[model samples]
Target: MIVKFFKNSGGGSANATMNYLLGKENDREGARLLSGDPELTKRLSDSLNFQNRYTVGVLSFEEVNLPDDDKRAIMESFESSLLAGLDKDQYNMTWIEHTDKERLELNFVIANVELTTGKRLQPYFDRVDRPLVENWKQVTNHEYGLTDPHDPDKAQAVKTLNRQNLPKEVQQLKAQI
Candidate 1:
């Protein structure tokens, strides 16, 4: 499981983000809203009058394909852990599930305005929040037995043929060739 944050557009609007998440801008096959109300989220952002109206990101699950129930549980866990400090009612989040790739992906758009105070809320700050997010990814991966992005062995290393180190079958086949 990997938590990847998208670079927030300076002038990003909630409606635009919602449209992208909803696959209006591009053809996203097998994409569906997992949670939250798009219209209400947009309305909340629109009411705020902030330039950067939302934070957009995706939680990518590599190699492990999960059922819808498990996916929802994972999503809830990730969201709750990632936004632990924020009260439930103070923020709004919209989750979209995408399974077009080999792994499952949950794309999210978080409205930046605090519902209670109408104040700008940046969900993630690089210097402060990155470690927390990274820790969450590591812990969640271990707990769910998902792929660990931090594992060096999990990375695809470039291969070069070592003639002497070839397997017996490969060496025999090569000799015949």
Candidate 2:
């Protein structure tokens, strides 16, 4: 599974962000809330005055189709592994599942504030948390036999470097070369 993180705009962005994730904007199909309450999550985020109200991320599985139960289990395991330091009650995570694409995606919005003390809870820090997150991803991918994100050769862009996936203009330019 490939992990991706999206920056949260500000305290008020949580409302709009939740709306988009819950498909309130486009009336998008197949976007279902698998866990947590959006309203409560927003409230928790707003309670603490921080530059970033929350953290948004997506767990994208490589084209291997799995049952909903299996996916949920995987997500649970991922949360446990990544956020082991934070207690379950300290932070609130809103999980949404999208099946519109070829790969299954588990999107999550975690409120940065702690529930008990209203303190900030940053799950993945760059310099400090990189090794832990990377190790987890590598071990998880190996355990599930998923595509290794660290391997450039396994990437779709590298695999199709003939420029077939690029836009017409880019493809034409490549052909001209």
Candidate 3:
């Protein structure tokens, strides 16, 4: 996965950081800082270690203060750099944003390259959010499985089944047989 990193400026959680990285610089100040500093750009790139990877593309958010013209220029530069360095046919691009709320949230955009026509591919989107870590322990330990007796053999059997390479449906078939 091509993981892009963006620092969040708003007082809000990492969600803001992620939103910024995805080119949604609705905030003005963050855009300005990101557009102006080459050092920052290089640092961001280095942090992500984008060199020689199948995942290609610009993975950062514009600082909020960047001028509109500069923001456009930076994006163009990033696009050019990515296109020049990687084969459009084989690789895909993605942007990842990190958020720190009561729950974790992830947003992803995937861009594919057309094989036959060699055109820039469009983006697909997905997102996920779940309660914080502590809540998970409470729910899993206290819920449906609680009243059920702990059977070590059954647990081992389940573990063995999981470790097998077969797909879930095939595993079910095997169990039935």
Candidate 4:
């Protein structure tokens, strides 16, 4: 799978993050915390109060060109690895999965940050995120007997790439056209 991390944004409240994730940036329905801090029931409202402190991480997946079922499974795998990869208990997240575009993309919003920790989350997001994603890709693909295109040495993927191409009929028809 192809994974791309958009720039992490700050100063936006959790409610706005929710709205944007849902493709409803202004919707009153707001955003919900899928996991973490169940006791913090007012995450959305409370986040609104901490606009400056909240941060967001948007990770998009595409170019793997897997089927719908495989994509959904990978999304789950992606989420788990992300939390484990961060190795921190400092985030409150909401995952928004979108297939409305040309490729299936997932938007992960790390909505809450602890200001007192006095650390910048950006470096972690930049340096650690992709490697964690690659590891998840390697593990998940191996489980299904697939090769990860992003894997180091990519020799196996290169061999498979030639076979996984447009159908012979499509190629012939294109030639005729």
Candidate 5:
């Protein structure tokens, strides 16, 4: 399955960000907040007192995939997607998974923008996320076939079972059977 990502911008955003992600607040408490690092999350929030920071949001494909079940894989995939687009190296990040919502999603609180080259650190959807997601879809589809129900095309949806049942060697195998 594929994962989708997005971004947002704001200030004092950390307290609110942490609260939302970690489920400290009232309405927010119900979400899974799958990641646990309260100390690191607090540190990340503390790191962004003055400078700029962007909230990089991550959303899983409509259907959750196996990797989604692994915290390490999810974190790695999230970071990989983040780094592949931006050149920045030194930045603080904290992400929380939203499971109780309509769709499974993750909100990454990224701050402490300290890129050596001083380039922008905020993730641009088109420039960074799209290509990554598209490439993931292509590669995974190529290997797994795009028919997974979560795939954009619903490649193997039962509604199209006719295609799955088609015989590849009708003439050659009819008599042998």
Candidate 6:
């Protein structure tokens, strides 16, 4: 499974910056962290600042039997990876577990990002429900804001016809007119 989390940039240029950070070039190190590979995490974090306000986790996971020791090892590895990935800033990690008669699930709140103005931002991570290639279709078709381009209320009729679509005499008359 692959999960992505994003924080909303208020709008305009802030949104562009967020988009760039999520791109391949700026997020190469962050992508390494998501791979659950310790060596890559170490190498990538050495050269990049993962603690930036726009930092997002792009996590990938495989299913395994639930074992305490194995879980501990994975968690510890992620903690070390995150620490090395981030810059020198205070951080908080929260873990949430929910159990019902049918199922039990665990969620890790790795970190909460804070803006320069001292406001804590909400994390907006999305779980990719499909394969990466199919997921591209979802992203490509997604509409981010409230506006709709094809809304009837906002549409206007074109006043002029194409010259090729017009009668030949109409074209000559339009030239004279």
State which candidate has the highest lDDT: 1
Best by TM-score: 1
56-151: candidate 5 lDDT, tens digit per residue: 456453534334445455565656765665442455566666666555555565654554643445544566567776665555545544334444
Residue pairs clashing, model 1: none
Which of candidates 3 and 4 is the stronger one according to TM-score?
4
Task: Give all TM-scores, in the order shown.
Answer: 0.79, 0.78, 0.24, 0.48, 0.53, 0.28
Question: What are the lDDT scores of the predictions, listed in order?
Answer: 0.78, 0.77, 0.33, 0.51, 0.54, 0.36
Runs in model 5 deviating more than 4 A are 1-7, 25-30, 33-39, 42-51, 64-71, 84-90, 115-120, 123-125, 137-177
The TM-score of candidate 5 is 0.53
Model with the higher TM-score, candidate 4 or 5: 5
**Model 1, TM vs. native:** 0.79
Better of 2 and 5 by TM-score: 2
lDDT of 1 by residue, 51-94 (tens): 77777888898863677887788888877886777777888988
Candidate 3 regions with alpha-carbon error over 4 angstroms:
1-63, 85-110, 115-177
* Overall local distance difference test of candidate 2: 0.77
Give lDDT tens digits, candidate 4, residues 22-55.
Answer: 6453232333333343224126324444434444
Worst 10 residues of 4 by lDDT: 25-34
What C-alpha lDDT does candidate 3 achieve relative to the native structure? 0.33
The clash tally of candidate 4 reads 0
Residue by residue across 4-93, what tens digits does model 2's lDDT show? Answer: 777545447677887777766636676777888888887777766787878888888875477778777778887888789777887899
Candidate 6 TM-score, C-alpha based: 0.28
Query: What is the C-alpha RMSD, rounded to one decimal, of candidate 3?
Result: 17.5
Task: By TM-score, rank the candidates, best first.
Answer: 1, 2, 5, 4, 6, 3
Pairs in clash, predicted candidate 2: none
Candidate 4 residues lying further than 4 Å off, grouped into runs, are 25-73, 85-91, 114-123, 141-177
